[model samples]
Target: MTILLFGITKDIVGSPTLSVPTSSVTGKQVPKTVRELKQFLGDTYPELNKLSSLAVAVNHNYANDDDTINSYDEIALIPPVSGG
Candidate 1:
């Protein structure tokens, strides 16, 4: 699967795009869901788990916990922002 990081998330991943492994589901390489993706990211980058909160976007649209993702889809990580 391909994950597109934004803002601070880009820094965390150290790049704009990330290639993640996928498991076979009915002979197709399906990407993990939003919840599973979170666990994957946390396992890959432990520091992100310490953040207050984060939002996820799939194909430029916001995603919920129950949303299922595919390897061909685009995913992005959005961290909380603060400015003054």
Candidate 2:
């Protein structure tokens, strides 16, 4: 799965896109849900865990923690926005 990063998430990740293996190449379980995805990303990129608020979207729709994900799904990480 490829995760698109926006705002601070991009800076934190050092890239606009991240590729996640569908199969465990490192003996770690592949993320099958939004919640697990977050945990996986946080584990790989500790800086992401520091964000006060983070939102995830799957296939252009906002996804909840329990939302199921697949290798072919489009995932995006949206950080909290602040504007006047």
* lDDT (Cα, 0-100) at 17 in candidate 1: 81
Q: Give the number of the best model, judged by lDDT.
A: 2
Candidate 1's TM-score reads 0.82
Tell me the tens digit of each residue's lDDT in model 2 across 1-84: 899999999999899999999998879999999999999999999999999989999999999999999999999999999999
- Candidate 1 regions exceeding 4 Å error are 24-31
Give all TM-scores, in the order shown: 0.82, 0.97
lDDT of all predictions, in order shown?
Answer: 0.81, 0.95
Candidate 1 C-alpha lDDT tens digits along 1-84: 888877778888789888787766445334468988888788779888987988999998999967998878888888899999
Worst 10 residues of 1 by lDDT: 23-32
- The model with the greatest TM-score is 2
TM-score of model 2 vs. true structure:
0.97
